[model samples]
Target chain A: MQSIGIDDILDMESRKRAAFINCLSGAKATNLIGTQDKQGRTNLSIMSSAFHVGATPPLMGLIIRPDPVPRHTLHNILETGYYTLNHVNQDILSAAHQTSARYDKDESEFGATGLTSQFVANIPAPFVAESAIKLGLKLVHHQELAVNKTHLVIGEIQTVLLPEDAVADDGHLAITEHGSVAVTGLDTYHELQPIARFKYAKVGQPVELLGE
Target chain B: MQSIGIDDILDMESRKRAAFINCLSGAKATNLIGTQDKQGRTNLSIMSSAFHVGATPPLMGLIIRPDPVPRHTLHNILETGYYTLNHVNQDILSAAHQTSARYDKDESEFGATGLTSQFVANIPAPFVAESAIKLGLKLVHHQELAVNKTHLVIGEIQTVLLPEDAVADDGHLAITEHGSVAVTGLDTYHELQPIARFKYAKVGQPVELLGE
Candidate 1:
């Protein structure tokens, strides 16, 4: 085996970058668009780095960078303990992406993006009406990553909004059929499509071998 | 606007459970299984739920359930100030998943899981040998997701390991080709193929135009 040092590890120019991008290439779930902070100040950002964390507590997480400028949402959430996570479906993918454009702290991305919002009880955050899955997130915890620039926000889902048709009879999420998008870094969208399905336990093994 | 209450949200039923199971359908990325305790007894669990939070501080997070019997890694991470986040590549996927099996407290999952252990300087946790990316994480905060059943553990990455070849000259991550796999709840793996690529600025847009 080749032994390498840390400095050596960091300095080498990579040869596999393109292939690496290709391998993990996925469409950003465009369904969740206009997420807002508790104090009612909002900023638009695009994300493809988001995914599920737990189900029993119905929890999910978002990794956010330090705001480019002072903003109310992050501060509001830290102080008020509530926020909303909205899905960006196909129709609103563009509007959702537009939210990420730098805006004045006092401006609402909802107005610029032209999306509607609703409120949940006990939670002060608002949900986007256009999303296929709307979640009222109760701020549970937040941690600053080592990079010193990102914060991992963990939220306990107090409530969820699902378009009845978006959930299949078997309880599997069919959000893509209604046009959910996936985000990569900040702004890239892909129309999600169901390539195949597998039993939960069948992971680690190939799908075809599992025999449906 | 159609109003819906949190009570109307469906509980975890068999079919609904399966719907969630199905959502893992094609999403795949390899994650480093982490095991650590307050006492500093660390084991490795290589699974992927690890996803990006946002780029501001550039955060990433993952989920872990109580051990099938008594939790060790999760328990240690909660008790101790730190744990290690390792990545599994195509090379270590089998070994990575094997770490999930039950083992005695002293029997390191690294031994059982077919992974080689390498520790980062000044940190107590270990990283996986085959991963293109590995991170050392410090427990920043956690919250009870369910009353007592599940706790969402959030950590800030204190150190990061990225393959020299996985990053582009432009500083963007080109990850898919490095052979990463993603998890649903547990035990599902899929090979990913990149269908397209986009500039960093265009990630979360509506699908109507992007898709066409």
Candidate 2:
């Protein structure tokens, strides 16, 4: 294994290093399009760096910067504790991408992007009507990482929405049948195809060559 | 708003419905993945369904179930107070998914999947060499979420490893370049892509609109 000194590591700039680490970390390839409220008005942001945290209570999380500068969605969710995670497919990818714009507070990205909002049950937040799959989240905790200027928004899932046909009997979801595109690195996006699925097996013991 | 009875809401068997509503109520999706002992014997489970309990010390967490399930990653890190977040990517997506299996103590998924191991300074546990990015972490606090069922593993990042080219001049990471994937519901994976980048702007309210 190649060993490098910690002093050599700290020399790298934070943001520049964050971008590089994000790529190698495989977290750069996300498209977690979301809609949140600002005083009852809605705003959208396309977050592509989200992943699962647990499954028992079914939790999920994503990191958000303080707008790189305080934005509406961050403000709304933190204050009200509610938001929606809408999946971006080929149909809404462009509009979903456009949702990342720096629009004014009264502005609605749903209106600007031409995506429809579907009201979730008992929640004021609306899900993207165009999303292939959408998950509603309630903010349980928020933390600012001192190591980096990033906000980790954690939520327990309340409702999960998926195209009926996409769900397999064995509980696997086939998202690609609907044609979803994922962010690969920084500027690139790619459509996904299922390579293979294997039975759940225990990890096997390593075989050692005895008479070599 | 379309109001549905709580009982009616509970009647839905769809994972989306449950995940969305439960999340909307207050849960945030966040976690940390941990590795095993000094010998790099075990690759444990994921943690931190509780995203941020504290910001001053930069705390992150994960909720892990007890054994008979064989979560080596969680056991090793908690015992040694060290682990690494091996960001899941397309290259090792299958292997990362496989790690969730109920493997035996003698088995090593790292070997089975052909993923290499690397070390970070001062941490006994090893990081995934094939990982596009890895964060070396030190356990800050470990607590039980509920009785006898789950655990909340919290940690502070001590060091980070990133690829050389993934960092950007403006401090933005183009992680999708490394082909990362995000999980949803219970066991579904999606690829990621970056469509566009937007400016982070501040918000202003009009008193006239709210009659303030």
**Model 1 lDDT, full chain set:** 0.54
> In terms of lDDT, which candidate is strongest?
2
DockQ, computed on Cα atoms, for candidate 2:
0.17
Share of real interface contacts recovered by each model? 0.14, 0.14
Tell me how many residue pairs clash in candidate 1. 66
Q: Write the per-residue lDDT of candidate 1 for residues B1-212, one digit (tens) a residue.
A: 23334344335574465345335222334566565565656687654555554322333455655535876767777666677665455566556655655677887877665567777666677777677666666776565544335555656555556665555544455444555444433444444344333432222343243234
Write down the worst ten-residue block by lDDT for model 1 chain B.
B199-208
- Whole-model lDDT values for every prediction: 0.54, 0.55
lDDT of candidate 2 over A60-162, digit per residue (tens) = 6676765454577778888778888776677766566666667777788777778887886756677887776677777876776445556667676676666
Docking quality tier of model 1: incorrect
Residue range B34-111, candidate 2, lDDT tens digits = 476656575644222333323233344555666565567667876788877766666765566556555666766566
